[model samples]
Target: MVRYAQTDETRPADCVIVLGAGTWEGEVSPVFAERLRHALDLYRSGLAPKIILTGGLDPRNTVTDAEAARRWVEAEGIPAQDVFMEEKSRYTHENFLYAGEIMAKEGWDDALVVSDPLHMKRAMLCARDFGVTAYSSPTPTSMYRSTGAKAKFLVRETGCMIVYGVWRLFGVRS
Candidate 1:
């Protein structure tokens, strides 16, 4: 996880994918905000021509993560035409599944996957599983900055990776 987080594969792609974290009452969490910031930087640098925001509704919130992120990026002056939304996924796998569908419709086969540094491995795996040629572009500043917080997330990510591996072995698609 540490090795993958330290790598940045930012490059021109069909689009920039901003993976969703949870939001509260339509306000993006700090983690999600950082992902957006990185994605925006990539967009501004001309790495990609479009941005795809992936996230669905949370039970505790009135709006989906995609909606909240779309609002935030639009407020940052991203035009509506350059922003796409995948608002039916509630997890990382589903995020790419749904985003893959969007990419198919749009004729996009590659993407710059944006998310927290620790989350890049799984995010890239999901993207590849869903048929996207994914390049990692992790957020520069992760919310899990402290040693303890980073360690905790690392453990959680290890477990998640194991579970995803098992699911892949079983041919689970979502």
Candidate 2:
């Protein structure tokens, strides 16, 4: 008999918020596409009944991350009514703050945060600061074993953790 680790009790939220990632010349990058794919999987797996695509238009680019994600998900057959877009945020902090407001207005208390695995820790902290009980659903990486990629992720995660710690200590709300 195989015994699996017990998973956390994750109740379905009114929405799942897919945080933005970089796009290459208006197209979704592989990392960004992975996040969207995870969000879709969450929906299909009954983790969340709805999804919120969060990001803003890059001044240099014509399309917003939210729009790109929405288009991709819709192409995958998710209904329009099941997707919400928060397209005014240009940073991770703004993504949580703006989306948190939307969730509150919609009477949602819980959310599944979909993002790169390396980002989920800080993202969850930011979401919690906004009064949302956020749970992370990291997008699985195909290159987790790459030494260079792992090093990059570690550096980024460490920097984010430091920033988040300072933000929380200073009573900063973002």
Candidate 3:
């Protein structure tokens, strides 16, 4: 099992999974950029051999968060071939489950998950449930900004965790 740490180690993994963030008007939000930046940093530092961008198009929204992440990563010069997309998940649970399936198919055992700091714990939980040894690489706070915004995100993440826990307890698909 991979141990969580306050700072990233830059140790290579089988893969690095970039969790999706909000997008606005076909553009990635600052938060989204922050998450992608962390994933890119991890990739460049040799923390992972491949990057998996995860998210799906919101039925009411035009662009999928995964697609936007891919575009930004490509613009940053990461080769298209090195970036993988999981575009069927709309939530964290689905993100881990779907990405885990892909990891299993590829025989990946270790992964570093990049996401907002507030969501790291739950994301790690989901990853562990999927049988992957996972660690967190939080997006920098400078990129997230605004205490109000971070607070809101933390609240939402906690709610998601609670809901997911109850669902699992009742044998419901999260």
lDDT value, residue 61 of candidate 2? 82
Each model's lDDT = 0.92, 0.79, 0.79
Q: Which ten residues in a row have the lowest lDDT in candidate 2?
A: 1-10
User: Per-residue alpha-carbon lDDT of model 3 for 125-156, expressed as tens digits?
Assistant: 78777666777776665354577875776677
Candidate 1 residue-wise lDDT, 99-121, digit = tens = 99899999997999999888998
What tens-digit string does per-residue lDDT give for candidate 2 at 1-174?
Answer: 001111223457777899998677878778788888878888998989989999999998889998888888889999999999999998787898899888878888889888766677677768877777887777665334588886787787788779778888998765
- Per-candidate TM-scores read 0.97, 0.87, 0.88
Model 1 poorest ten-residue lDDT run: 1-10
- Native-to-model Cα distance after best TM-score fit, residue 130 in candidate 1, in Å: 1.2
Q: How close to the true structure is residue 17 of candidate 2, measured as C-alpha lDDT?
A: 90
**Which pairs clash (backbone N, Cα, C closer than 3 Å) in model 2?**
none
List the RMSD of every prediction in angstroms: 0.9, 4.2, 3.0
Question: CA shift at 81, candidate 3, in angstroms?
Answer: 1.4
Best by the lDDT measure: 1
